[model samples]
Target: MNWTDSLEIAIALDEAHPDISPLTVGFVDLREMVMALAEFEDEAEKSGEKILEAIQMNWIEERE
Candidate 1:
């Protein structure tokens, strides 16, 4: 999944880190986590703040 696959990334993140709070995640860490996901496949330099924010927002929604 790439930057556009925010919901998928969020789901993976939730499953991978169920103990963590999305609200406390920084963009840098979030990006790294996304890149670390086994299903993730994208250019590392293609991500930006907007993509990270979208991922974080979806992660928050997933927790709720």
Candidate 2:
């Protein structure tokens, strides 16, 4: 799957398992949130690069 797909999966899972106050299930930590965002951004950047590469080649490819 692509980075977008991974991000979508993460969001969907989070939504479906929404955290409970007493549990960590749906808890959203500021730090973790930032980290996840940054990580996603970084991964997304890779996706862009991959897209560029494919474009330059006049083809399509998925991130490895």
Q: Give the TM-scores of the predictions, in the order they appear.
A: 0.97, 0.24
Clashes of each: 0, 1
lDDT by residue (tens digit), candidate 2, 1-64: 3343443434433443345221232223322332354333433334444433332222111111
Q: What is the C-alpha RMSD of each candidate to the true structure, in Å?
A: 0.5, 13.4
- lDDT of model 1 at position 51: 91
TM-score of 2: 0.24
Best by TM-score: 1
Ten contiguous residues minimizing lDDT sum, candidate 2: 55-64
lDDT value for model 2:
0.33
| lDDT (CA) per prediction | 0.95, 0.33
Q: Flag regions of model 1 displaced more than 4 Å.
A: none
